[model samples]
Target chain A: MRAELFLQYLVSGLIYGSIYAAVAIGFNIIYNATGIINFAQGEFAMLGGMIASSLASRLPLALAMAAAVAATTLVGIGMERAFLRRIARGGVLKMIIATIGLSIAIREIALLIWGESVRTLPFFSGTEVSSVGIAGAHFSPQVFWVLGVTALVVAALTAFFKLTLIGKAMRGCSANREGASLCGIDPDLMVTLAFGLSAAIGAIAGCAVAPLTQTHYAIGTGLGIKGFTVAAFGGLGNSLAAVGAGLILGMLESFSIIVVPEAYKDVVSIVVLLAVLFAKPSGIFGSRAAGALKDY
Target chain B: MLKARNLEAGYGPLRVLKGLSLHVAPGEIVAIIGANGAGKSTLLGSLAGLVRPTSGSVTLRGEDVTGSRPERMLAAGCSLVPEGRKLFAPMTVRENLELGGYSVRRRLGRKAFEEDLAGVFELFPRLGERQGQLAGTMSGGEQQMLAIGRSLMSRPELIMLDEPSMGLAPLVIKQIFSAISALRSRGKTVLVVEQNAKAILKIASRGYVMETGSLVLEGTGQELLANRDVQRAYLGKEYSSIADEREGR
Candidate 1:
């Protein structure tokens, strides 16, 4: 491949990688708190994009994005209060299945409201024709936006978990629910917060990437699978590793165009997911002993 | 400091605690000794609000707190060091201790919370030395100390422990009992359940012998320790005496 093309692919990979990393982090947050993989995680992104795009017709872009994120967060909290919390007594498998049902329900609702038409938020900085040139490679400025938002989210989340009382309490619930409750930390409240936080992060990623990928009701399913692949590739509970795994997966898929047709690009992710599951079920960064102790 | 009346609690269809009742006065160390299946842990669970009692009343510091939930129990100044320690294995000792103070941290203020942390470290200097170490990486004895220290961080007026010597060496058990004894000096009420009847009764001001789901004997620690039935059932003195006689020792 030519140097310029390589740089373009790398930038493209980084943009998509940041979005995937955000989605994977969403999965990690909920999984760590509840011990269930929330399949509706991707729909949170779709909701953000769709809500923001609709509001963008009448409101400022930044306001629309912020409102969309806040609204999605409420939806996340509602999901927990209405479905997850009610069915929590049914065990982890039941809760996971509920998330799958929720994902479908959310997608159908999005279709009902937004229809089949594709939607996109206006670029934060410039139109589609506007591009930034970096080292002979030209890409949309939204790439920088996506990268920036992901980095900020990661940093903020790290500080929240490390420095704040609520964050440590949430970690307490994740480490041991019984122990946490005994310590006067409400497990239910932490789980609700986890859902809200995960949804907000996913929404931010969705809004940031909307101008580039365009939003459709059906985008959630694809994003959900890809995000899960990245999360599993990193390790289910480890968020930092998910970022690296997302970038690696994104780069592999982007560069696969050199060897395979565009139609086969998605095949790369599926292959990687299967290979990781079969060879190292714990994740790339997780030690074998630690992996053995965890329930995939 | 703590009172339970007609407490009936169990996992569905299996009645573990059948109308048991007990009380612990302020600044007293009360011990409950029972066999493995006597529902001793369930008793602590019900009082700490981890397990909902089917029918009962738990009064703490003159307030009715039955089935109030664990956080509420903590708010009422009651804390339970649950069986097996249940430490947040992935978190550091300081973090574990910090979380134990979660309920009262705001009320205690930052300065007071730090004092509480310092108090826990003072109680278990080993924990202080390894403040940054993960709870799971500690030895069994150290983990027990961390568990006790974590509960103490809450500044609970009433602290309940479930089997503090469940799986410890003789020396470690002695260390744990000494710490429990030390709680009395600090003016904290302790309600402890133990299978090690002999050791617990030594430090316990008062003791109860539970069987099935009811207290069969209640007396001062010295009286229970000298009771023939308690010695036969829990201390194994009768069996040891019989073996000695058979071997002509």
Candidate 2:
């Protein structure tokens, strides 16, 4: 491959990779807190993009994005309180199925509200024609926004889980719910917060990538699968590893177009996901002993 | 500081605790000793709000906290060191201790929280030295100490321990019992359940002998330790031989 083409693919991979990483982090947050793979996670991103674009006409872009994130967060909290919490004793499998139902419901509702037409947020800094040239490759400024926001979100979440009292309590809940409750840390509250936090992060990623990928009501399913693939590849429940896994998957998908047709690009991630599941269900970064202990 | 009255709790139809009642006064060490299936752990679970009572009341510091959630129980200044320690294995000792104080942190403010952390470290200097070590990586005895220290971090007026000596060496059991004795000096009330009747009865001011979910005998530790039935049922070969001889075996 030519150097310029390779740079373009690399930039494209990084952009998608960061978005996948954000989505995987969302998965990790909820998984760590509640041990449920929330299938509706990607819909949170779709909701952010759709809501922000709709509100952009009436509100400033930044304000619109913030409102969208907040609204999505509320939706996430409601999902937990109204649905997940109610059937919590039903065990993890039932809860996972419920999330799948929720994802379909959200997608259908979004379709009703936003129609089938694709929408995109305006470029964060410069117009579509504007580009920053590096070496021989040119890229839009929005690429920086996507990368910067993802990095910021990762750092903030890392700090939150590591340093804050509530964050430690949340970790306590995930580590041992009964133990946490005995310590006077409410597991239910932590789980609800997990849902809200994951949704907020998802929304931010959704909004960041909207200008480049364009938002459609049906985008969530694809994004959800890709994000899950990254999460599983990185070793579920390990967020930092998810970022690396996301980048690797993204790069593979981006570069796969050289050998396979663009239409078959999605096949690359699916193959990776299947291979990881079959060969090392615990994930690439997860220890064999630790993986054996987890339910996957 | 803690009272449980007519408590009826169980898992499904099993009925582990059948209308059991117990109380611990402020600054007292009350020990409950029974066989493996005697529902001692269940009693602690119900009192600490881990298991909801089908019928009864749990009072903490003059407040009727029956059937309240665990966090509410903690907020009311009651903490339980559950069976097997139940430490957050992945977290550090400091993190575990910090989380134990979660319910009162906002109410007590940052300074008090820090003090409580320092106080826990003081109680278990081993924990202090290994503050950065993961809870799961600790030895059984250190983990038990961490569990007790974590409970103390909440500054709980009433602390309930379920089988603190379940799986410890004789020396470790002595260390844990000494720590329980020390809690009385600090003016904290303790309700400890144990299968090691002799050891717990040594430091306990009062003790109860439970069998099949009912307290068959209750008395001062010395009286219970000297009781023929308690000796026969719980104290094992040495005392059981004496009791057996008294009963004409």
Off by over 4 Å in 2: A289-296, B238-240, B243-249
* Candidate 2 lDDT by residue in tens digits, B94-202: 8988888786686777888899988887788999899999888889999999999989988888889999988899999899899999998998999999989998998
Model 1 lDDT tens row, B1-249: 888999999998999888978889998899999898899998899999989999979898789999999989988889999998988888899899999888778677778789998888888899999999988888999999999998998889999999999889999999999999999899999999999999999999999999998888999999998787888899988767856755899
What are the TM values for chain B, all candidates? Answer: 0.95, 0.95
DockQ per model, Cα:
0.68, 0.67
Error of 1 at A204 (Å): 0.4
* Native contacts matched by each model: 0.81, 0.85
Q: Tell me each candidate's i-RMS in Å.
A: 2.0, 2.3
Tell how far residue B59 is off in model 2, in angstroms: 2.5
Count of clashing pairs, candidate 1: 0
lDDT of 1 at B169: 96
- Which pairs clash inside model 2? none
